[model samples]
Target: MPAVLSPTYREVCLWQEQVPREPLPADPLPHEVDVLVVGAGYCGLSAGASAATAGATTLVLDKEPLGWGASSRNGGMVIPELKAGPEKLAKKYGQLGRDLYAEVDAAFDHTEALVKEIDCDYVRSGQLYLAHTPSHTPHLRDFAGELQRSGQDVQFLDAAQVRERIGSTAFDSAIFFPKVGGLHPAKFHDGLAKRALAAGAIVHDRTAVTGLRRQAGGFEVQTTRGPVRAAQVIIGTNAQMDAAVPELAKRILPINSYIIATEPLTADQLQLIGPQMMVDTKNLLFYWRLTPDGRMVFGGRNQLDPVDVPTAREFLYDNMVRIHPQLTGVAVEYAWTGYVAMTLDRLPHVGTVDGAWYATGCNGTGVSLNTWLGDRLGKVVTGQEPPPAFAELKHPAIPLKPLSSSYLPMVGRYFALQDRR
Candidate 1:
């Protein structure tokens, strides 16, 4: 097995330090509920909240503590777009593609509303998509044009303007989306979980679902604690899937992504990078932003192999210094990793099979997409409305499932090479 980080290292995620830990219930989970949702991340918790609000007896289960997965470990960027470019989507799916983009735009609106309702430390300072190579500039321009044509707010920045905004000469150009923003992910998760509980959802942590099978009225879900029977089950486990849901495992690939956070910087040091969520245009991308406490939280897809805190700190720090040589000897105080699920189409999917509902494959846009999809899934399960267009789209299983473990690393390598070019 790959070396696992010690408990101290695992606590390195800066988000975990921002909120007080909520205690789980000692009372045994009821014999059953109207709905049993798996995974306690944003999706599961949001789904639980929605279901309970609609008067369903909802219970959320997670293998680890609440908000312990990518929900809290991510870079806290609330971007409203997908990995697939708008032009490509337009060419392939036409009006449907455009509609999907609109849905993503609305997701940002939904997120903004939630941030306000929850009163978390959210900033609408916007996002910068920097071009890592000169050749990538035209693509950024095209993307900006597509956004403008679709009636979205955007601005294109030249190399000099990019340097002025982010204080980085590494990028050739950039595209700015005024509506994109950042937040304290763990705090947001905590607020959402509290809302779910307040809405009458029981959340059980350290309860991993071991087996799931169809029963007479609903489904029988076996967990570490015991068996749970529900009229419906919603699998919100994005990239952290194991054997609990074999069907979902075959449809998504779980790739490791890492991040490193530097010690809180001086106000002068913070001036080197302005306060905006920033990401570079690369197949294997690099994204960074300033934490609310003024730390530079930098992250990327450096490698597919499992990494410990020390190794990740070194790798990400070296890359950070390359982007901003002024930070050459900066201290990296934290390091952590999260699993991001990638689908064959690089888009999120929501649907049902064998009387169970699921929403997964966020492809790195989980902060916004997952939360939105979770609410939609709740409505679907409650018979409130139909699934959205993206959910109705086919979610095909990945090819050659047996070799994915060996093949994904090679795929990562190919993307890394492309990023260099």
Candidate 2:
């Protein structure tokens, strides 16, 4: 018999393999609901649960299976801040910036509480942001000082300290956030789905919402299955918004991020790399963490164009080896790619547009922010709370829609050059 070849792309990730399989809902889709939630990722599910709790008849619809997008595909780091530093944020919005920081801090606290309540394998191992070059150390220091002023518990580690903690000499210095941590993304997504279902929200997977039109009551949502007349509609399809909502698509530039997981490592290998979620200080960042099962999961940004799985796997593996040369010969067990929604301002936007509400544009920090926004939007729809402060910010559409794909590669190359310097 001819030798069997391993598949290049993984059908599912390591996190998906750990969680119990989610079967499609058996009940038929209702023709009407109080609130219709599009996209069953973290945000949608979170909104569904909160809406149901607030006595709204909520239904969540998704094009793929639950947790099919970045919710399950992310690096699983619960970062509470945006790409912008604290000082920049304070300088820009002043009091509003401080309020935004407080909200994100609450999100971080809520995430830890939710993880414990959901009984998932979450580690409070914290996170380390490494400086990729000597010149980056000052930036890290400034960032740490700003965070400290904001009441965040952060420490700046020198090269020797970084090596002691990370067991790698590739980084120059590091900023350690003692509150951040990692969790099983698929498991957390599953927990949210179950909570939503239990809270009386109907979940319909593999049911894509194609269009939305304002009607007499609220909006008529056109879906693959049928039309759903909802009193209100919330779009939570971050990064995967294709043709569903043209307005949202214009505001979000979807970029692909790839990840690779190595085979299970020994106890000694685990000790070499300390138990902390790690990321580098680069415009095009590289993030990595050890899974609960002891596998090294490393991820980074890739070219804007479509890339084959083998190529993505090779690229991620080379970067992983560059960080830790000892893992040179380790076999990669899984490789996958997911889309990240990038906005013009590099911040998340949550507000109403054209009679429909939305919470998206995570800009690479989605795990905690998505959960908070989803729940907060649900409250806003139910009249339980006001719109978040982020809703006040302007969300402008990208300049040229037809030529957007070429933009990311150019930006990535520029950032790569800066990292080399």
Candidate 3:
């Protein structure tokens, strides 16, 4: 479960980029607890914090130090629902689907509230989905209809209108959703972990959950440090859960997502880009926005790989220029990449396995979805009846192949080539 092979994120511009990281000690874990949660990212930490506050003896474990996974390196866009459009979700779940969206919207609200209460740097500036080509415009307009039907405040724009609002002629059209926003992901992750520790949750970092056994009344988990027995278990590992639970791993593909940060620009330069967060429509998508520190944080993914600095810089720089040619002259201050879990359906899998509980496969929607799942999983662990929406959810297994690891490069290259169209 160590993200030793996981992707890295840029170290400049982000609020928590080079902040002092808490060390995960080599101490042994105690033998028993009321709850044992795997993975110390947002979902695990949030779940642990809630459980501990409810007076449950909770313990959280991670294979590497905190902030070592997607939780820390993600784009921090807290989009308040699944990747599926409203029309699709409605067709799929009927009235139940609408109710589910409401639940997720509440999840996003809880995240903002928690950030404020914890004194984390959070914002509600909103997010825009930009369109670069004529063919892309229709999709954005259709998306606006679906978003409006979902009870979201969405505005569609033409090329001139978008250019006026964003100060860039790069987009042919765009969709703005006030409900979606951005944040400092790493800070939020660390803040949640700190609050969990303060509330009496025992968090073990650099600790890997090596084995699992079904006990008579509960489950016993083995870690690198020692063993832990608990009445309930939660898995918040996402795509990184492969070695820990192979069955769940096959259902989710871990893809490398890259991000780049520019040096702080002058107020005049920032004015050229305007203030909102924006992403474009392409099979291989890219998102670019101004950080609170006045630097541009741009990101997107076309494939999965073990990304390094050189490859990340080249890939991101080339793609960024296609959207905003003026940025061709801008210097890249930093570049990094991280792996995210993607499901075939592009929806998160939240359900129980045996007596073990789990919340994984957020696709690219992990920021808000993970927090929501964490809150829901916390309720489930405390024996409260889970919401009706989660009852019918199931994890569709991922097809495994002998050449799976080697499969990334080929799939990625194909998409990269196709994205240029």
> What lDDT does candidate 3 reach at residue 210?
85
Best by TM-score: 2
Predicted candidate 2 versus true structure: per-residue lDDT over 1-421, tens digit per residue: 1111244436357777677565775577899999999999989999999999999999999898777789988889988888887778889999887777878877888788799878668888989999999999998999899889878899999999998887799999999998888888998999999999999999999899999999897999999998989999989999998897898899998888888888888888889997899999877788999998998999886555557666777787888888887677777878788889989898889878788989999988889989988998999999999988888888899889778676756767777787786
Clashes of 3: 2
Q: What are the RMSDs of all candidates, in order?
A: 3.1, 2.8, 4.3
| lDDT for model 1 | 0.84
Winner on TM-score between 2 and 3 is: 2
Candidate 1: which stretches are off by over 4 Å? 1-11
Write down the lDDT of every candidate, Cα atoms only. 0.84, 0.86, 0.77
Two-way lDDT contest, 1 vs 3, winner: 1
How does each model score on TM-score? 0.95, 0.96, 0.92
Candidate 1 lDDT by residue in tens digits, 174-241: 99988888989998899889989999999999889987999899999999988988998999999988
- Best-to-worst order by lDDT is 2, 1, 3
- A best-first ranking of the candidates according to their TM-score comes to 2, 1, 3
Candidate 2: segments with Cα more than 4 A from true spot: 1-11
Question: Between prediction 1 and prediction 2, which has the larger TM-score?
Answer: 2
